[model samples]
Target chain A: MVDSVTTINSDGSRYFLYPADARGRFSLARRLSAYGLIVVYLLLPWIPVGGHPAVFIDIAERRFHFLGYTLAAQDTWLLFFGVSGLGFALFFLTALFGRLWCGWACPQTVFLDHVFRRIERWLEGDAVARRALQLAPMGPSKFARRAVKHLLYFFASLLITHLFLAYFVSLPELWLFMRAAPGEHWAAFLFVFIAAGLLYFNFAWFREQLCIVICPYGRLQSALTDDHTLVIGYDARRGEPRGRAGTPAAGACIACNRCVQVCPTGIDIRHGLQLECIGCAACIDACDEVMTKIHRPLGLVRYDSLAGLTGGVTRWVRPRTILYGGLLLLGIIVATFAFSSVQPANFLIYRMSGAAYFVGAEEVRDQFMVRIVNKRPTPATFTVSLEGLPAGMRQTGFLAPVTLAAQEELVSPLILLIDRKYYHGAFKFTVKVADAARTFSLARSVEFMGPDANLLTEDDHEKHRHR
Target chain B: MNSQPQPPHGPEAEPALRPHSYDGIREYDQRLPNWWLNTLYGAIVFWIAYWFVYMIAGLVPSDGAQVDAAMARIEATKMASSIDVTNDDKFWEMSTNPVFVEAGKQTYNSLCFPCHLASLRGKSENPTAIGPDLTDTAWIHGGTPKEMYVTIKNGVIAKGMPAWDPVIGQKKASEVLAYILSYHKKGGTITLQAP
Candidate 1:
């Protein structure tokens, strides 16, 4: 019955699928796209941008470089926009074209269908032969084929995981680590092996089960998509009645079961849109190839909205789409602004670990610690200056432009002293630091703390009288 | 497309629906996949092994003991790197060393210059400066190198000189002391002054 899962036997044992290969336009297009994605993945760490890998996430240095721009650990708050932007974009796309990412761009599908499945097909022949081989006893020929196939799977997984590690350590450092003994970099070594093992297990035996049971996106289709959303469906209106080729009053469907045979998830598409479908368009291609041979029009099973499949017009502009699109657009705008506003340096002003303000015989003073951090990969000189100080106030420390090495930080005391004559109680002032090239500047406002102005003048009068 | 249903596989009949219904919804009583069940069994086996090794058998050291050992190693390294603050001749030697003086100068300019002035002259260089002159042999607290170390390490609170030992630690405090001593001779004329 269609009520139960096709890949689960009645005895509760696993039921592996041997999906027949489908060849048509959609299959060809998806193959090309998957290959393009795989090439992009493999080349990102090899390509250098601005003296670093294109997408290096240098966790050891706590600097994440995307394209040419770099972000220090302090700029980690920008990750909020990145994560949310991806979420909203997915929501919008899912509401518009259902499960497009799953069938096309998802790493699981790309690796499993394009990479591992091709290896399996080349070694074991077509679907029927593969099923027969599985049913047969463990002979020498069968054992050798299984061993070679699994060995190849393990190697492919290891290669992928090694490239994945290059994203974090960069290609040059990864090469160094690869050449070194595993004991020297035990953590990274363990990580790569463990990740590769997991990938091998996932791609080798746990194939369609991951999409049907593990992935939450497939389950969210009902909530993310509606009637008008594009989905691969059977045209029940045009292909309902079952009949042979020459039967009168028969619909276009000739009961060839080509759609069911080519299903990767093993669900009958003619039974209508179901959760098991990943929307890969395999059934559409299979049905088209079948209908063309029998002198019937194509699209017996095709990509169409549920409304269109039921002989109704599909509405593209729905309330769900507008909301999702608006949210995605807002996230993009905010993410752009946040990324552009990231400064190449950071500074902070804090009270030195002492009395907030010092009072001496001839002056009133405020002491602060100004900490400056250069986030660039090269050395830069920063000039520290004070602004909005009262007249007759003298400044000390960081008088000259201090040069800091790459990613270096410095903490120095900034002392501001006002002569007793010009000391007019406590006031607010700014401590500003800027690069030598005047590329950017950071300022912090600090309140000069002291006793009342009247008290100082009264003390002065008392001193004069004593003299 | 046929009205007739296909026969169920294996020895089992059709999957039986649960007797109870909640708002017209009854779930089927289907057995879980063997592979999924194997994962549960594997987790149980791992838990037993881990508990036996780490908790009951105690083959591995406790986390607390590991932390204590790490802390002791750090303490040993700290003690090895620390210098004797009470040695007067060592202070004089560090004062004469150019590397020590240069490092001390950097620390001095960053911190001590605010009160003592960049020249270490304090009130002598500018009448408005906050601290006493370090260049003079007259000492308000003490005149010897050890006494100067003590004064710098534990400042005179009544005079507004902060205790710097906690802020800069023993090493940088000693370095700043060396920078101050760089301006003076080892046996220069010394006089005691009342605060």
Candidate 2:
């Protein structure tokens, strides 16, 4: 309402932006970033780290593998902290540099500006030829070119889909899926098929509408950015009341509109910051190229913070940035400590379902059930024994080791038999369990009722015989 | 009657296709991206090929059939490695063999000894043993092998005898029954504590 700039109209007609090709210092950096990001996206799923995919999510088993470390379903808290750390990092970056990610690093912009543009320029020629071809009459040459271009887009979408699917399924399993019959894996097939179609639409048509209308990350800009946030800005004060070059005592700007033509989202930078700008530095490149021809100094459109534009110093350190940084560091420390101390198997012991305790001729017996879960991804053998067996207590009734597979639990019956003489009130002992190799051990304490020890003596055997 | 003239595409160099003005702004009729149109056409082509192989020619099996086949393969691997004690007739035949009795004695000592005692007399002082005396000529249920096998498998619930089939599996359960039957036929006088 303030500047009379609207992107989507009620009439359903939109002005298309055709940014001319630009080569500059920033352009080189943006291009390199685009290549690096695309490579990471494509190759991350294929590489193996510690016998696992570098990053994989096995949804069926609720396991996540990140850089060789595996986190089971119970360890979901670690994943939550990891996500929060990423969020804090984003906040910190936004506070220092306004919308830098949206311009140079965002996938939407990178694909459109780097990949799709190169494809477009290679086939349809520059901006002028592209516009002419659109208005030109239908012909065989035009149809052939259109067909080839579309074919390339379809195949490109399929490649991207394959790379995307690698993050969820393991490599060998994915290979098996690829070799399997289509109907056998119809669910996976349909997912990739539909995803390819969507990617094609996004890269080819949706373009800036994805960034301008949908991405809520941009909406956070207003709240996150302060006066010190560096953004691509045009110095309107010195360049206004514009005129053609060489007019006596005229303002520096010639009203060329080259900056507008070079913008990915077609907005004149001279109108100040707008939501559609994206801060790509394309206008800066275009303006500088023009300034060189006109024998004037460059930097008409440049990276300047709000304070700098208003003749004030740009402050780099602020309270908001410090808070986000501190939180991110704290999340990493706490998550690492918790992950290291997690138990491999959870042990629980309780009295058997039937009787509490029973006295035999020479011994007292209490039935119990030891429940154990093997948390590893492989089978483990466990031997259970009673620790602190005061004087004469023995483990009886199936004194053998048990083996359980991944995530499997056992509720085997156990009976603790202690000599009647050793029976006393409130005796404490621990149920100790270790793997066959004694690699690890777990202990839990349980209590049993007994006759008073003081009453016991050489006459205890006589009392046992009477019972 | 006056016919309206068509609007002109604003100075062809710019992005505008028509000269119609809205808030003093111009809009061009930009052709849809060639890649987008091609992708739609490609999808149509792909769907046709998929329909031919998966629907018409029937190259892929139905989901249910595929799953059933995979399940059978897994079950077969597990079945081949263990004794098929599920067949009660075959298990009864095997129970009469000398090898089964030998194995059965080991199972009885480990599992049945606590209640029946090494003496097989089923005698205990405090709380009294729940297991019936195995040497008695009068069987609690029946003296027949089938009756004893069923007793071991199903257990006498009211007498606090938990079913052994689930805990030790069918093979071991059959063996334990064989061990008890051996003593019943011989009327062994073995004693643990002279009781």
Candidate 3:
């Protein structure tokens, strides 16, 4: 390698260091990436976040608790809007840049990069050794390595499958099922088996095909991205008219092909950006190594927009990006405010039967249904009362205060009877809920219907008084 | 129109075509197959037969079944209402009912004897019977008929009282409420004592 440092000018910045070289084999990186996919994909579900599974989609109770927020079926529309907003934002981000998520933030990419690579490196050795092992005939060395690697991979895949189950059915419940006898929880066992099988098949064999074909996000990325978005690109201007290092003046174009050797997807960046490229910066690392050896400037391959490379008119402000970003911020604010404004507990009131309005041997009376919910971890009692009604109106069934156990709901049927003379049309009443510590109130209005005023005569009143 | 030569494996191997029609609109012949038609016909025939037997012929279930279904609906509604912790329809009813209030006073004097004392006045030893001060409007649970029903049914297991749901039943939970609610306006008296 040359002693002098190389400098490449792109995006109005100077790079003093050269890119990395293809010291690691492409096959090794691929195998390693595969192994990483196994570990992360397996462990993701099992990883607990605040005593809860990282991911869960509980659709049965019409309650979905993702992370910590318990979303009721009523909140399904809110979730839908949030998801759509996220999708739009992602689309906008991708349109400006090609396959950025595919290489970086995507779970699939992150898993494959961090988990599989480490495992593969541990088992089959580095890129070159793995490639050599692949090429080797059926011998003891190959057999040992292959057996150990396959066993490790399968175990990792199994762990990943378990974690996936934990995400859907809470870890505690799943753990109980696992601890039970095999025949006892046949349904649970079946679920675990099938889910694990799917996960194992995915990471073990599906691999890159998942990113290229199965993932719709990658396909949609092409539609969202414009030529202006920053992407990993090869400076065909400098690196072309390709020839060896000691050849005639052919620019800085050293056709070493290290860039190709290091690429995980096996695509030539020099051919310009393609859908298959994950933009992993491996090519940058590789080409930098080549530049160092030849004592030339680096960054034959780098991240840049078309405008940036061409040195033409470039505007940083893109309408779609700005709009999507603004919307995302707005959604976040709304979600935050909604969660902050209301305590998790909720209350509902309904009128009961067997009475309408009055208290006598023969009188009209009304019955109501009142419900209290305690959302806290500890059991609590709520003092409930009514407002916006006349002073004579009273709730007669419950103790002065109603206590609810932790996460418990109390339903009370009450009787409300106003004197026939006093009872009338629609009335609005507010139900106030209070613990010893704090109070929350909700209001509801209901119409009171009864027989006409003529239904009760002076004689009827006299009979009721005698009774 | 002239016949176009087919490109040998280019990006566009198939040429896009426009249909000819009398109007501006043209349509594609996409129709359900015979098997699908047969399945649909079978479904319709089955539905008609089922409807004739169940509705027209009066050959379905009895009135008892209808009653059972109604009961089931009531039970389901109760369960749904139970899941909600903030509803107090029963309490509201009791609060408004003088008779229930009278019944509640009776229950309070009987059940609340040892701890709450005879006058509905709280005792230092029992100290409100391991419960809230019924006389005070500041209730720990609530002051509604429904709330009273629930508290009586499911006693504070965390506190001293056992959950009465298994023992007393929901109807009696209301009776217990009546007894306790009687003490709401009356406390600090040595009115009744247990034998």
Candidate 4:
């Protein structure tokens, strides 16, 4: 088969295919794994952990609830770590085995190969029937089948869109949105329909083009793979010098072309290490079946590195693999450290925006606004008191023991009054907050207008003599 | 199974076409795909350019700038209009306007309420309360409305008062001045709140 990404068949005709269904141990293994993955994807959104949806990323409110932990928008850096970790892992895996992800668990491949293809096969029958149906003229019977198939595609697309939306919105919010009139949330309405359209287009039309042309991972795998990297390939050394029916051949290859017909990405395995090979092991199963029928030794096409085929050794502890592995480990460690030590509370103090310092009848006053974020699972009630402050520095507003709900943020206004005796210039003091149970405490220091020791040595004799 | 394994490529007359073995796999002497190389190098070049434009040159603001911009957005959204104290015309015009004075009063009450007291009637005998009363004719720095505006904008450094213009922005300073001037008592009855 031609390796080039084109719609034309090798015989120079339009290539529209219903690839012959693969029935091998590898195919069975993949189908079972896809079932498990699809179940997990469907169930994750509804599962509640620590009173939050399992993996909700509430962008509007700036809160991410991952598994059992709730993180604020301030912790967005963690997402960077998570994404980079995935990237590094991909690199490491690609260096070890070529295109393993593209075939087995890639979302695009999984949905099309396992979900969409199954539905198509069940509806239209096998490869011969599917091809015949496509060629047949429009009639009542055909129109009815076509309509039902498209309706099923629409429903499947809808289900996928629901799952995708559930990640950003809580299950309850999603239900509410669903029950409301579409016009109320115009943007969301548009997004859901647009996503469905894209999914339909991808599954029905784009298909293998996603792997052959659009996917950067295929290109990346080629770049990362050396001769030692493992990949599924036909053993051209054993399988070559094709044997025709009723003709003796030097090589084992019977030239039945079962491997070519079973391929998903539509590439011949005999062509050494093409970019389109997804390492799904479908051809290996098909070739092994053919070899079994011919009463020959198995593994005409198999999972092996080019080095292994060429009489070389495979090194698992190479420098490039170790480098990728080391970085992946480091990323995980740093992420764990950060997640474990996430601050339970964050506090900030700003001198009130408008006025400088106020002179009261009995004291010199300075107003401040305190902002606090409760970064814990439970509701927090904390009493704010001043530290490193001289005696007679009292506060009136904001009765102590401020309470906030779980993941709540509060801004409080307060007045600090220094008794007439202690109006020192810019006195430094700490604003401390302690939980009512005294379980935890956080502090932030601030400057207030108070007696400056410099006042005693004032060169401003006129103001000093008046005092 | 042949007696010995044979290489896949046909007998190559040209050295360039000959498949060389490394670690057992036959290595085809081919360069990496252009797309992959371009993308890898593009990210490197982009990162350097990003560093030059944002971090080193400071053309784009960092985290602090983002916070400041957010604050400025909030400031713009506030009930009061953007105050321009740089121009003397806008300063005095806003000072006399009742609306500006009202906005200033709101700002003063929240920001200055801790020290100045809600009444704006300061005490002279006690050092802590010894701040000159706004209502009283006697002025520590200058008595005129313009002088008070300047003093409030650029505070008396020797004294504890901070320069509010930079912190609260200039227009708000003029508003505070207007609020203060509105009650610059001309020997009237002291309108003090109950203490």
Candidate 5:
């Protein structure tokens, strides 16, 4: 009832009548808007802020910043979990809805429907012009139209290629190379150039073949979907017992096949659910317009499950969806906790050097190196000390202590010397580092290596100590 | 339904395909396209190359190893810069003078106070458990200055303590050693023990 009106243009002319096959629904401007949206999307990753590349996957640096968070190499497991969670989420959604992602949000489908379709309409005219032009004989006018179409395609393709590069290589670097002479950046320029041409050719010409054969998601739909899953399906029961409403027998499906015509994937919804149907709702829009004209209820062709059409409830809360959602929620909580609990930096402890060996006097000397990592966005200072060392052992590295710059690592090594009389056995020492205020201590343990022979016997040590 | 007569057919005409057409759309069996197959093969090739370069070559170390190596390098480099003549004064200075003890205490507070605490209290989270409780008499390593110096220099790697040979030289080790020894003879209530 919300959209139950069926009216037409001014005048009582039947020329604009509705029940006739709906033609010229999509105008030239509307089509171009679709193409322009894609161009804008492709260009976003390359647009830079400040000197930094807007999006960088500097895997070599072991630091990747997507929006702004600098994910270090240590966060690789988090990446793994994140990707897995995403993959499962996609699977669950697809299993329940049947190519909903492909229809509405997939980059591939959006670009093809909007960009490629617009370009095609521009070159060959509307659907009628396109069909007529296909049968037209070779002539200067035809050649000119064809040439213009392809030239635009190539230009659009070039833009796509550059944007893809920006996603990986970062926009700032690309801009620097672009600003230089062609000779200076021939390698980069050439790669982007070829990439654009390839993308253009793929989206412009190859088109629907990508969904049918290349995409695994389409193939996996059969495995993911069931009778209860909703998809763009023709109500074969109603549509089958179908004929023109104005005709002698009016079940109201005149079988005009306009739904098939507008489908980007070139599949007929009337044939029931097919993998080729991206569920773009183009057919729905087309059929709805037809129904309105023919004075029949809308939704003769609509999103519905096989079970629903077969006189069963749609069942909004399926068991599979609930299970998948629970797993996804659990994964999200774990990932959140892992991310929050991570220390902002590394904690380190080192043995002092030159204390490793004893001189002719039989003194043992060894050396050590200690380092601290500051993972904050600003500079931080930390105090370092040794713990769990034997009663007499201590650390000797710092005089004024050290401060680490933002994302910096500071290393300091110390030396320890032991008299032969004190040489007992290997002992463990714990190293503790704290921020300048000594509020939080990050601790680790290390051993003090020394000769066991010089250690006083247990009884001797006790006797000597008592004195 | 019979308003229009059927058109004449040629001798090789095929039978009407029934039960198939919905609103005049005839289904035809068409195989998958060639371009798709080619692209899939191309992706496989790219994947193989990536796998070889990144996984088989061992070019990238694990994240944990990288962190450990980075800390070790920093420690080594720092110790190399601090070696000097400070050890001789400590050896001869008899270090028991309150002047020396106060100086040592200042140094300890500034440098070691974070882990050991201003009260010589031990922290629980220290990975190495570096500073023992000064109040306890358990001298796992002897309480002598020389023993303290050696323990400071040659850190135990297995327990997470780095050898500080690169940051502090032999001389600085001795000064800190003298500082620790001063604590031993002084009538301080602090004792070394477990936290």
Candidate 6:
């Protein structure tokens, strides 16, 4: 067992690993799931759901569409729920199953292990042959293999990044941008190329180093996990005092080191659970394969908790897991409620850029600018009305239902006047905006400013006395 | 599993620990990967070059200068699109055009209708309206196109008319004037009256 990072040499140089292939149930299941995830990633921009791509962001228009639901810029606060909900979900999963996301779902692990490594394995053969090719001096055959492998990696990266861009710009717009001159859409062009370059650099060479050295989730394992967390661990009780088969006083382990050979991060699983373990179960599969061949029971190295490996029962319902799960449930509920509450339009009522209120000869008036924004994809007619206003109050502008085009916004004056007989002190009233069909409504409480009622009455009495 | 040479301390030798211990926990001082070190060095070099170019050599324009240039460009565009407010004939011509009048009427109804009334007859139609009658031959602030334009652009502040030029730009202000002119004849009687 090495005390330091296994993938880094004592001299600080990179020790590249070529993990041997382990063909077993876990590996096969992982491969199928990875393929499913990749297909979903590629098809999201192609499948149209409710007139838009299934997951279009539409950054230029500031509308984010997921499935059929759309969120306008005014609904940006909902992003807090979306982000926090994902965070709590990750925390809950991590507390229950150690590094399951890193092994099965992380884009870095998925692309590197399945796509890039598969390409390398096909071109340069298995672990032993790949290592030999790496050590061999430059030759025509070796050069051709390396060049072709790198070319394929680059193209794969470009494909991934282009699809990523399509999520924001939509597929048709991305196609237009691609066909246009680079100078015409230089920002998007530069973004795509830069992203593709970074992805190629990551998947091609920076494999397990990302999980071991860079990923914050891997670093968070110690804090998020405990003895009850399911993890990939070796059974020291069964596999200790390793020796050849049929040797007396030796445990079941033949000291074959098959588990270490298949480890992508180059760590010995028999040394116990380490930070480098991504829970890929490669070591488990390798050990199981060897145990079966030797006519012994499988699972010398297997998925179990620290307690389970030590012959203790694993507690599945711990306090840590319960807290995380509860939080996650709360987040989901709140996010669902918040998303449903988002209205199809936004409105703001602000005092106009003059006096707060004007007192005329026979009336008291207030001027306001009502800005209405229609966030829906279709034109909507909205009816504006004053609620809880005193009698004899007059409202001008928005006398009829105003119709706004798709995603259009309009700012217009709204004037309210009261006859001297009905003049009252400054008061608060509600400005109600409802759809023409009265399906949904939004209201903002606005204060109508005016002079004191007694002051207006005093002026009237003074004028009357003088007359 | 290749037969690579082990470190000089032997395969079973443990890594040496650092001198300091915090709360019963000690750390191993391992070397950072050469690739990570190279990235750090690259960032330092980039920072030095950026500092020299932007701060010392002044090769790229400062952020303030860039903002100023952008603002200047926007001002130039606004000036180019603005109508000639001083031209009386242009205002009369625009009043005769239905396109200008329609756009102006929309703006007027949305903003000016409360005080002036939708019919543009202010107190004449409704005695308690805020503004004076616009359709009348008598003019409080001169009734000619240019005078009326001045009155609309820079408002009569004492009488509660807001300066429309800043609220709506010069173009929309002129459009509003065109809509008002559509109600009157060019050579009609004009009598200046006291407020």
- Candidate closer to the true structure by lDDT (higher is better), 5 or 6: 6
Candidate 4 lDDT over A102-185, as tens digits, reads: 878998888888888888888888776777888899899889888888888878888899888989987788888899999987
Model 4, which residues run further than 4 Å from truth?
A1-3, A6-14, A244-249, A358-365, A383-399, A417-445, A449-467, B1-195
Q: What is the lDDT of residue A289 in candidate 2?
A: 84
Candidate 6: segments with Cα more than 4 A from true spot: B1-10, B16-27, B117-138, B156-160
lDDT at position B145, candidate 5: 49
Write the residue-wise lDDT of candidate 3 on A154-238 in tens digits: 7766666667667667677778878999789897688777766665555545455466445787666566666677788888778
Tens digits of per-residue lDDT, candidate 5, A1-467, equal: 00110111112111111111223333333345555667657655755543345566665466566555556666677886679788778767876787878876677766666666567776776666775676799899999988888888888777677777677666767788779998898988889887877778777666666676578988888877888888877776667666655666556578776775666554556767776777777777778887887777888778788788666777757877787777778888888898776665677665443335432232445656677777665688877776565544444455455787877876645545455466577667676787887646688877767655544355457767889
Clashing pairs in 6: none
Q: What pairs collide in candidate 2?
A: B16-B28, B17-B28
Chain B vs. true chain B: TM-score per candidate: 0.84, 0.51, 0.40, 0.54, 0.39, 0.87
Could you report the Cα RMSD, in angstroms, for every candidate shown? 3.3, 9.5, 14.4, 10.1, 13.9, 2.5
lDDT of 3 at A127: 59
iRMS values for every prediction: 5.6, 11.8, 23.1, 11.0, 17.7, 3.1
TM-score of each: 0.92, 0.70, 0.62, 0.70, 0.63, 0.94
Rank all candidate structures by their lDDT, best first, as comma-separated numbers. Answer: 6, 1, 4, 2, 5, 3
Off by over 4 Å in 5: A1-55, A137-139, A181-187, A248-250, A347-366, A398-401, A414-424, A434-442, A453-467, B1-32, B36-195
lDDT of 5: 0.62
DockQ of each: 0.39, 0.07, 0.03, 0.06, 0.04, 0.46
* Consecutive 10-residue window with the lowest summed lDDT within model 2 chain A: A1-10
lDDT of 3 by residue, B60-154 (tens): 87678889999999999878754333444444445457876676565454345433455554434343232345554555554554555666676
Give the higher-TM-score candidate: 3 or 4: 4
Question: For candidate 6, what is the TM-score?
Answer: 0.94
lDDT of 1 at A198: 94
Model 3, global lDDT: 0.58
Candidate 5 per-residue C-alpha lDDT over B69-149 given as tens digits, one digit per residue, 9 for 90 to 100: 999999898688644433444433545666656666755654555445556644333433344554345554444444556
- As for model 4, its CA RMSD to the true structure in angstroms is 10.1
How many clashes (backbone N, Cα, C below 3 Å) per candidate?
0, 2, 88, 18, 94, 0
**Candidate closer to the true structure by lDDT (higher is better), 3 or 5:** 5
